[model samples]
Target: MQINCTVIIQAFNFLITYLFLRKFFFHPTVQLIKQKDTAKKILAEKLKLKELAVSNLVAKKNSDLDAFRYSISQRYQKPEQAVIQIEPNVLSKQEVIVSPEVIEECKNSILKGVHNAL
Candidate 1:
Protein backbone atom coordinates (compact mmCIF):
# COMPACT_ATOMS: atom_id res chain seq x y z
CA MET A 1 0.00 0.00 0.00
CA GLN A 2 1.33 3.41 -1.02
CA ILE A 3 0.74 6.40 1.32
CA ASN A 4 0.22 9.75 -0.46
CA CYS A 5 1.69 12.92 1.07
CA THR A 6 -1.16 15.07 -0.43
CA VAL A 7 -3.82 12.93 1.34
CA ILE A 8 -2.19 13.46 4.79
CA ILE A 9 -1.89 17.22 4.14
CA GLN A 10 -5.56 17.43 3.06
CA ALA A 11 -6.70 15.55 6.20
CA PHE A 12 -4.66 17.88 8.46
CA ASN A 13 -6.10 20.95 6.71
CA PHE A 14 -9.70 19.68 7.16
CA LEU A 15 -9.21 19.06 10.91
CA ILE A 16 -7.70 22.53 11.49
CA THR A 17 -10.53 24.25 9.56
CA TYR A 18 -13.18 22.32 11.52
CA LEU A 19 -11.59 23.28 14.86
CA PHE A 20 -11.34 26.96 13.91
CA LEU A 21 -14.99 27.14 12.79
CA ARG A 22 -16.19 25.30 15.94
CA LYS A 23 -14.22 27.63 18.25
CA PHE A 24 -14.93 31.04 16.64
CA PHE A 25 -18.09 30.72 14.57
CA PHE A 26 -20.34 27.73 15.44
CA HIS A 27 -20.07 28.01 19.25
CA PRO A 28 -20.77 31.75 19.34
CA THR A 29 -23.72 31.38 16.96
CA VAL A 30 -25.22 28.62 19.13
CA GLN A 31 -24.81 30.76 22.27
CA LEU A 32 -26.43 33.79 20.58
CA ILE A 33 -29.43 31.65 19.52
CA LYS A 34 -29.81 30.37 23.11
CA GLN A 35 -29.64 33.95 24.49
CA LYS A 36 -32.35 35.11 22.08
CA ASP A 37 -34.63 32.23 23.19
CA THR A 38 -34.04 33.17 26.85
CA ALA A 39 -34.91 36.80 26.11
CA LYS A 40 -38.16 35.81 24.34
CA LYS A 41 -39.21 33.66 27.33
CA ILE A 42 -38.49 36.49 29.78
CA LEU A 43 -40.52 38.98 27.70
CA ALA A 44 -43.45 36.54 27.43
CA GLU A 45 -43.51 36.07 31.24
CA LYS A 46 -43.44 39.85 31.81
CA LEU A 47 -46.29 40.36 29.35
CA LYS A 48 -48.40 37.72 31.16
CA LEU A 49 -47.76 39.47 34.48
CA LYS A 50 -48.76 42.85 33.01
CA GLU A 51 -51.96 41.37 31.55
CA LEU A 52 -52.93 39.94 34.95
CA ALA A 53 -52.25 43.29 36.61
CA VAL A 54 -54.44 45.12 34.08
CA SER A 55 -57.28 42.64 34.57
CA ASN A 56 -57.08 43.15 38.35
CA LEU A 57 -57.25 46.94 37.88
CA VAL A 58 -60.32 46.62 35.61
CA ALA A 59 -62.09 44.38 38.15
CA LYS A 60 -61.34 46.90 40.94
CA LYS A 61 -62.73 49.78 38.85
CA ASN A 62 -65.95 47.83 38.08
CA SER A 63 -66.47 47.04 41.75
CA ASP A 64 -65.91 50.68 42.72
CA LEU A 65 -68.40 51.85 40.09
CA ASP A 66 -71.01 49.35 41.33
CA ALA A 67 -70.54 50.51 44.94
CA PHE A 68 -70.90 54.16 43.90
CA ARG A 69 -74.08 53.37 41.94
CA TYR A 70 -75.53 51.50 44.96
CA SER A 71 -74.73 54.44 47.25
CA ILE A 72 -76.41 56.88 44.81
CA SER A 73 -79.54 54.66 44.62
CA GLN A 74 -79.77 54.51 48.47
CA ARG A 75 -79.31 58.28 48.79
CA TYR A 76 -81.97 59.09 46.17
CA GLN A 77 -84.36 56.37 47.42
CA LYS A 78 -84.74 55.36 43.74
CA PRO A 79 -82.71 52.49 42.25
CA GLU A 80 -83.72 53.35 38.64
CA GLN A 81 -82.54 56.98 38.96
CA ALA A 82 -78.99 55.79 39.84
CA VAL A 83 -78.50 54.29 36.35
CA ILE A 84 -76.55 56.44 33.89
CA GLN A 85 -78.77 58.10 31.27
CA ILE A 86 -78.15 57.06 27.64
CA GLU A 87 -77.83 59.87 25.10
CA PRO A 88 -79.56 58.08 22.22
CA ASN A 89 -83.26 57.63 23.24
CA VAL A 90 -83.76 54.71 20.86
CA LEU A 91 -81.08 52.57 22.56
CA SER A 92 -82.59 52.86 26.06
CA LYS A 93 -85.10 50.04 26.85
CA GLN A 94 -86.69 51.97 29.74
CA GLU A 95 -89.52 54.20 28.56
CA VAL A 96 -88.89 57.78 29.70
CA ILE A 97 -92.02 59.97 29.79
CA VAL A 98 -91.36 62.91 27.48
CA SER A 99 -91.17 66.18 29.39
CA PRO A 100 -92.73 69.31 27.76
CA GLU A 101 -89.23 70.83 27.45
CA VAL A 102 -87.92 67.71 25.66
CA ILE A 103 -91.02 67.60 23.41
CA GLU A 104 -90.55 71.26 22.48
CA GLU A 105 -86.85 70.66 21.76
CA CYS A 106 -87.68 67.67 19.56
CA LYS A 107 -90.35 69.65 17.69
CA ASN A 108 -87.91 72.54 17.12
CA SER A 109 -85.17 70.17 15.93
CA ILE A 110 -87.59 68.49 13.50
CA LEU A 111 -88.74 71.89 12.15
CA LYS A 112 -85.09 72.96 11.77
CA GLY A 113 -84.34 69.76 9.72
CA VAL A 114 -81.88 68.48 12.38
CA HIS A 115 -82.13 64.67 12.69
CA ASN A 116 -79.65 64.08 15.58
CA ALA A 117 -81.81 65.41 18.50
CA LEU A 118 -84.31 62.56 18.32
Candidate 2:
Protein backbone atom coordinates (compact mmCIF):
# COMPACT_ATOMS: atom_id res chain seq x y z
CA MET A 1 0.00 0.00 0.00
CA GLN A 2 2.81 2.42 0.77
CA ILE A 3 4.53 1.68 -2.57
CA ASN A 4 1.29 2.54 -4.43
CA CYS A 5 1.14 5.93 -2.68
CA THR A 6 4.75 6.66 -3.67
CA VAL A 7 4.08 5.95 -7.33
CA ILE A 8 1.03 8.29 -7.41
CA ILE A 9 3.11 11.09 -5.82
CA GLN A 10 5.82 10.70 -8.49
CA ALA A 11 3.24 10.96 -11.29
CA PHE A 12 1.75 14.16 -9.87
CA ASN A 13 5.23 15.71 -9.55
CA PHE A 14 5.99 14.99 -13.19
CA LEU A 15 2.72 16.57 -14.36
CA ILE A 16 3.38 19.82 -12.47
CA THR A 17 6.91 20.09 -13.93
CA TYR A 18 5.63 19.61 -17.47
CA LEU A 19 2.94 22.28 -17.05
CA PHE A 20 5.41 24.82 -15.62
CA LEU A 21 7.89 24.39 -18.49
CA ARG A 22 5.13 24.82 -21.09
CA LYS A 23 3.87 28.02 -19.48
CA PHE A 24 7.33 29.62 -19.21
CA PHE A 25 8.85 28.57 -22.60
CA PHE A 26 6.18 27.55 -25.16
CA HIS A 27 3.95 30.61 -24.58
CA PRO A 28 6.71 33.17 -25.29
CA THR A 29 7.96 31.18 -28.30
CA VAL A 30 4.49 31.41 -29.86
CA GLN A 31 4.26 35.17 -29.15
CA LEU A 32 7.67 35.80 -30.75
CA ILE A 33 6.63 33.87 -33.91
CA LYS A 34 3.44 35.95 -34.18
CA GLN A 35 5.40 39.19 -33.92
CA LYS A 36 7.82 38.11 -36.64
CA ASP A 37 4.92 37.32 -38.99
CA THR A 38 3.33 40.74 -38.46
CA ALA A 39 6.64 42.51 -39.16
CA LYS A 40 7.07 40.64 -42.45
CA LYS A 41 3.53 41.52 -43.52
CA ILE A 42 4.10 45.23 -42.88
CA LEU A 43 7.37 45.27 -44.81
CA ALA A 44 5.79 43.57 -47.83
CA GLU A 45 2.97 46.08 -47.89
CA LYS A 46 5.40 49.03 -47.87
CA LEU A 47 7.47 47.59 -50.74
CA LYS A 48 4.33 47.03 -52.83
CA LEU A 49 3.26 50.63 -52.33
CA LYS A 50 6.68 51.93 -53.43
CA GLU A 51 6.59 49.83 -56.60
CA LEU A 52 3.15 51.09 -57.55
CA ALA A 53 4.21 54.73 -57.18
CA VAL A 54 7.25 54.21 -59.43
CA SER A 55 5.12 52.51 -62.09
CA ASN A 56 2.65 55.42 -62.13
CA LEU A 57 5.45 57.98 -62.47
CA VAL A 58 6.98 56.10 -65.41
CA ALA A 59 3.60 55.93 -67.17
CA LYS A 60 3.08 59.67 -66.80
CA LYS A 61 6.58 60.47 -68.14
CA ASN A 62 6.09 58.21 -71.17
CA SER A 63 2.78 59.88 -71.94
CA ASP A 64 4.41 63.32 -71.86
CA LEU A 65 7.20 62.19 -74.19
CA ASP A 66 4.68 60.76 -76.66
CA ALA A 67 2.70 64.02 -76.71
CA PHE A 68 5.87 66.07 -77.40
CA ARG A 69 6.83 63.77 -80.30
CA TYR A 70 3.35 64.11 -81.83
CA SER A 71 3.43 67.92 -81.58
CA ILE A 72 6.89 68.22 -83.20
CA SER A 73 5.95 65.95 -86.13
CA GLN A 74 2.80 67.94 -86.79
CA ARG A 75 4.68 71.26 -86.77
CA TYR A 76 7.37 70.28 -89.34
CA GLN A 77 5.31 68.13 -91.71
CA LYS A 78 5.16 69.41 -95.35
CA PRO A 79 4.70 68.29 -98.95
CA GLU A 80 7.63 66.81 -100.91
CA GLN A 81 9.85 68.99 -103.18
CA ALA A 82 8.35 67.25 -106.27
CA VAL A 83 5.19 69.38 -105.80
CA ILE A 84 6.90 72.03 -108.06
CA GLN A 85 8.58 71.68 -111.50
CA ILE A 86 11.23 73.81 -113.30
CA GLU A 87 10.74 75.50 -116.69
CA PRO A 88 11.43 73.38 -119.80
CA ASN A 89 14.09 75.78 -121.13
CA VAL A 90 16.06 75.85 -117.80
CA LEU A 91 19.92 75.71 -118.43
CA SER A 92 19.32 75.26 -122.16
CA LYS A 93 22.72 76.78 -122.95
CA GLN A 94 24.74 74.79 -120.34
CA GLU A 95 23.45 71.27 -121.20
CA VAL A 96 26.33 69.12 -122.68
CA ILE A 97 25.46 66.82 -125.58
CA VAL A 98 27.32 63.46 -126.01
CA SER A 99 29.29 63.46 -129.32
CA PRO A 100 29.29 60.75 -132.06
CA GLU A 101 32.84 59.71 -130.89
CA VAL A 102 31.32 58.30 -127.60
CA ILE A 103 28.79 56.25 -129.63
CA GLU A 104 31.60 54.87 -131.87
CA GLU A 105 33.61 53.79 -128.80
CA CYS A 106 30.63 51.76 -127.42
CA LYS A 107 30.20 50.06 -130.82
CA ASN A 108 33.92 49.06 -130.91
CA SER A 109 33.58 47.45 -127.40
CA ILE A 110 30.73 45.16 -128.60
CA LEU A 111 32.72 44.21 -131.72
CA LYS A 112 35.73 43.24 -129.60
CA GLY A 113 33.51 41.01 -127.37
CA VAL A 114 32.07 39.22 -130.48
CA HIS A 115 35.57 38.61 -131.85
CA ASN A 116 36.69 36.97 -128.51
CA ALA A 117 33.71 34.49 -128.58
CA LEU A 118 34.43 33.34 -132.13
lDDT for each residue of candidate 1 in 44-103, tens digit (9 for 90 to 100): 999999999999999999999999999988887732333334457663787888899989
Best by lDDT: 1
Query: In order, how many clashes per candidate?
Result: 0, 0
- Model 2 has a clash total of 0
Clashes of 1: 0
Cα lDDT for residue 8, candidate 1:
100
Model 2 lDDT per residue over 1-118, tens place? 2568878889999999889878998888999999999999999999999999999999999999999999989997864443233346733688656679967975886676556544
Clashing pairs in 2: none
